[model samples]
Target chain A: MIRVSRYQLVLMLVWTVLATGILTMPATMATFSVRDTWLSSWGILLGGTLCAGLAWCHVRLFPDRSLTAAMELAFGRFAGKLAAVWVVIWLVITLATICREFGVFVTTIALPNTPEYLVVALALACSAYLVYLGLEVVGRVNEFLVPIAAIVFPLLFVLALRWFDWTPLQPVLADGWLPVWRAGVVPAFAYGLEFSLALQWVPYLNNPRALPVDILLSAGISALVLMGLVLITDGVIGAPVAYLNYPVLEVVRAIRVGKFVERLDTWYAMGVVSTLVLKQAAFQTGLAEAFRTLCGTRDPRWSIWPTALLVWSLAYFLFRNSADVSRFILHTVPGYFLFTAVLLPLLVYAAAFFRGVRPASRAGAGEARR
Target chain B: MIGLAVGAAVLGVLFQGWQAVRYGDGPGAGAWTVWGMLALAAVAVSVVVQARWWPDANPLGWLAALFDGITSWIYLGWSA
Candidate 1:
């Protein structure tokens, strides 16, 4: 059986959540809560912690199965298949959007001359290969890249201290807690809700006993990093950040020490772009796993490339330009995430409850027989 | 370059799937049938949406557009 150590597992968990959030959270949060983006990040903490808590509860109930498999036990065969298929659809479009989102960032900012489709295709290609190799290999790659992101992101924050201003964050909660609650209610929760993917791999962890602590650390760490990024991006870029698309990029672009080291957004993108690709890979892995369970596939490998193809197609056909990508990310995505990650799962949980499923339910172990 | 990459992906999935089938992880007909269809769907992306209300007339997009309204109402009806 494939196995990953806790350290690798934790890093996979961290990057799976942080890779997308690091780039967009500051500005995305600013779009709603404005100058109080930092305070608004409390939504991320609470929602992330709660979302992680939900995943933790999910695995606790279905200890030996994936989300689809757990749903089979919780709901029953037909309903479970229906729910899992929708989850698959969610994975397909979300991965498509992630690819498109990152592809736009890369072509626009990093590789100005490269074709966007090519960048997206290259990412799906890498994902197909790593996913066929399975999560252990993907975990190892993340072990290296997450630390680079961990270090480089913080280093950028420290270097950008030259432009950090406290006045922008002042006039705190001028609009009261409603906007904070609104920002936290959906957007931040959706970001944390990405942790839903981690539940798919929990049953395979070699040391399964430490699962909650690992998830908690992952949640706490991801939330802290996002909140920190929000603080620095808003502090450095000020109120304009609310309207700007890539606040963190501008923060890094603004750095200039003795005129020697500016234009470091390229270096920053170098570290983050891998994290983004791996994020898509990581999501593709879980998506394929869910696909396998629903299809009764002979092996996990059957689903990888085919799923990659679906995502590539969706990435191409979904959005027209960066504006379409941004508008979808800002408005459409959170609710869709709410559907698959929160509401759908809660419906299954309700089914489990109505049917007398418990945290210690042993229905999980024998679920594969179905 | 794109052709080579897509070809590699197709072959890579075949190789990986073949290994599992050889090991008798399970049998192939049903799984491979579905895989072939999906791979074909991916390769023929432009053809899939040849004529539609919008160029992006994906079934997945339809589902998202459908349920997003329902779920958004469920989640955002009172809050946010």
Candidate 2:
């Protein structure tokens, strides 16, 4: 199929992880770990990289099969289909939740006059179109967008140094390591394990052997950026970061370079939106592929529109407002994602090993039989 | 709001008709039919909600409220 360069894959992974977390990570972590929020991020980085590494091993063991096909090979046909269905449902819900998050963020912060449904509808339209274009287009688009984010993100950090206060992060481990551990769970599940979605793209990669290294490198870079944002938000905004809904947005809003460079929050918003588009494209593509596996279809393009509509409807009517959305994100999403992303892979890997399933010689050919 | 709902319903029906013609009895025809029906139903419900036809009978709102209630109970450890 669709082939993507290692560089494209790394950029896609980094952008997808950074998309939604960048805005809320600091505040969410601060709420739990307080001054030790940055430390908690380190735990997330390590956990996420480990999860990626585990996924790499699984892919290496079964180079031909997508995660869904591998599940079938490991657990037999019927049971594997059931597990694959669960993964697909998880992916669909995740996509809906992400769309809801984006809609709420835009309506609350950027475009108050717009209806949430309208914003979500437009986003779904764009993302669905991108998904229809296939993985190659998505990879290239990410290749273009990631560089802008890479440059602007660090520059924003540098400019905000005027407001950086290291005193707020003082007395490290004041509450001991438990709170930090608890705090790390949010980012660990939300950002780290999300790379599980990358498993779907393994077969499409040009050089499958490099997938693990690329994923690890991307996870490390994303972790550093996330940690930097948390540090800056906690330091500049101090303890109050715990109360702010979007601490990173506030941090960007506070940066005033003379008069011309003020209101850089708009720039930050643009970057977040770009990353979100890429993330949605990735999720939508994965969902389509999952559906194809389920329906025994060769093309997933026809499935994209229906899926987009379904996601839009669910995201629109699923929650009362942003508060409910946030509650779902904090309470429900972590556990749900952990089960699908971390535990499911481990289970599949164990099953595959116990069954002694050999790696296929040609990708997709063996998978087509099952 | 009612006008918007009506417009959405019409647009959804038109899109589905196009899809049905374009992909006649193809791989995704069934999906197109199901989604088209859902889009229409969702818009109709929105219209009803906007019109306040049943006053207190907004199913989508009720569903959201019910979910929130369940989540709160779970968060609060099911206090009696």
Candidate 3:
């Protein structure tokens, strides 16, 4: 019912494309990955892109409806509902993880005295309000915010150049590709988080023809940003970056540009806030859509409270703490995301191709080719 | 309502103490920011809770909620 321009959608994506995924989790990952963190980031990018491409193929296969509808067409009623359930659970988990991340960052850096739950509650209310306004507002806000992030991130590094110690990254790839590959775990699947919303983004984009390309471009741009951050942080702080609880904040704190622009992490914190807002908004909107599908309703506004309350309660129990959440992500979530966002779509796309049953003319791949 | 308010106030006091313990050490004075953040958190908890109960209720409630959301990162190790 709401119209969103391709530019707005792409902007929304740019914010989600970065920090919320790999950069947010890199502190834990750097412990395992070591100095090869930047290279590993690229490795994850390749893996996530393949998954996104596969999902895009499925979207192409069923243009009129989303993955939920496509599943109904491909499998019967029961299996379709099951697949829809998986998608919904994935989104709910994503929402909760982001909320926890919000709390972790706040308590660790800015508000040590505050109750973690309070910070999370504040984040949730903002996201709920955004979802209530509909995707268009979310998209426009993302457009405004993403560019500020893009500008500030590089500026953070430039300011840190005064403190740059190139020796730490010197033994680059010293531990070999094994550690790098392991470290890339966080960034690799980070972009795939956005793929969870393919069901929603597919319908709203002004040019479905350009959607995949834009996603691919967004992925590439975000990957570069991750690489730059990894390289700069590693170069500045070296292995100590891995030890710090929150590497990005540490990197910002390390910046002291000739005494005039000290304590810039406060500003860098704004970038963090903006990215989390966009990521949370995207995930919640998708969650709302899935609820609409499951309950057989066209109205998302009516179900917002139930969905928010459920997500809040679920996030409460999902993981024991930030460390537990990080461990779960390190060990399990990537492969699960691969199956849902990557392999399943490919399976469906191959079936459609082999069956000689042509999907709509302007669906995913068809439009991409045009 | 007062019970909840008192509970939040107690949390505020604990938070301020926690800030003093964590970042409120001698030399840096970063803990002053911590005190400010604790105050912000108290305001945030009240605001967010109110919004959840009765959204679009009052402009003051809305502003407090927004402040908390945007400033949630103010207390982190790097955020301040």
Candidate 4:
């Protein structure tokens, strides 16, 4: 088996939590909360922390098992396989959504006139190679890419600050806390509950004890970045952010400092592509791992290809339009991700307790004490 | 004859330089080649896993074996 350090896992989690939400968060939050857009990021912080914290407990219970394997530990073999199937299917659908969204954004923005199928296929192919190499390589690749996002996001925020106006964010809580909470909580599931996928990386962590802190820190950093982006986007573009499909792109297009810094799409594009690759690789790896467990196979490398085919087909062929992708992410994703990422693990934990099943390591520890 | 010539060229390009043509040109195509080789290596690895693990049956035949044991393994527990 391959091992990854806690630091690597945390880096990957930050991408998982932040990637898809970068462009969409500002618009979605502004749409719901208006001037209270920044207010909703608090809900993001809370929702992300809580979802990850629950997954932390799930990891604590099954230190040595992947999420799917833990389901096997809780349920009978057949039902365990059923649970694994459910998780695999969820990963497939969600991954296809992310892949399709990636295709839409890249083809529409960066590489127009290029075939969408080719873009999606090539991207997934790269992600498949990362999966084939296993988690350690995936973690290292993400570690390399993190600096790109870390640098680009803050720099983008600073450059876009020239347009920041205080008026747009005024009258905070005009609609009170309800709308803010509603706006924040929904996107939190979109960004936060995905921490559950990090639980699959738990068994690979070199320092298992560090998992909780790393989990929270990753989500916390994501929330902070998300919160700052929302505020900056709102302050810079004001009420118009609500209407823009990609507020971050608008924020990028708005940046103009002398001749050199005008419309820093090149910088912004790097950030977008970096996060997109990281997120897709994370999902593809997780889906392949869960799939291997389901098939009772020892290796997950080959399985990545088959799963890539499914993701490619669903992304390019099945999903018809970019609007459908947007609607699905906004309307459908929160509840769907909540069930699989949060509630399913919680149920599996309950089942573990009901069956009086404990982690093998814990049992060994108890025996040692005796 | 011209249509046939064009079709042959297209097929040859797809077969020989599919990675370059399918992905793009320049650095992008180079990145595609590196990952494309890795993807092909993964397909090769799957064959190895198949031969090593399930020489008698299909690669994913664990479920098939479990299906036969359905009545016996209905009750749940560790490794049940």
What is each model's TM-score for chain A? 0.92, 0.95, 0.90, 0.94
The CAPRI classification for model 4 reads as incorrect
Query: After superposition, which runs of candidate 2 have C-alpha atoms over 4 Å from their true positions?
Result: A368-370, B1-80
- Candidates' C-alpha lDDT: 0.70, 0.73, 0.61, 0.68
Stretches of candidate 4 above 4 Å error? A362-370, B1-80
- Residue B47 in model 4: shift from native, Å? 27
Best-fitting candidate, measured by DockQ? 1
TM-score for each prediction?
0.85, 0.83, 0.76, 0.79
- Among all candidates shown, the one with the greatest lDDT: 2
TM per candidate, chain B: 0.42, 0.44, 0.35, 0.39
> What range of 10 consecutive residues in model 3 chain A has the weakest lDDT sum?
A361-370
Cα RMSD to native, each candidate? 4.1, 5.1, 15.3, 12.7
Which window of ten consecutive residues has the lowest lDDT sum in model 4 chain A?
A361-370
Between candidates 2 and 3, which one is better according to TM-score?
A: 2
DockQ of each: 0.23, 0.11, 0.02, 0.02
Error in Å for residue A256 of model 2: 1.3
> How many residue pairs clash (N, CA or C atoms closer than 3 angstroms) in each of the candidate models, in the order given?
0, 0, 11, 0
Q: What's the residue-level lDDT of A65 in candidate 2?
A: 58
The docking category that best describes candidate 3 is incorrect
Q: Please give the distance, in angstroms, between residue A298's alpha carbon in candidate 4 and its true position after superposition.
A: 1.1
Stretches of candidate 1 off by over 4 Å are A353-370, B1-47, B50-53, B56-80
Candidate 3 residue lDDT tens string, B1-80: 32343345445445444444453433323443344335434544564565467544542233234333322222121111
Candidate 1 residue lDDT tens string, A1-370: 6776888888887787777777777766776666676666655555456556666667656666677767877878667766777787678778877998888888878788988878888888887798888788988898877567667777887999988888988888888876676566444556767877776775566665566677778777776777788888878888788778788888888888786877889888887788887889888888877766765554567768756765675576667676776656655666777667777777776777677776553334433332
Poorest lDDT segment (10 consecutive residues) of candidate 1 chain A: A361-370
Instruction: Please tell me what DockQ candidate 2 reaches.
Output: 0.11
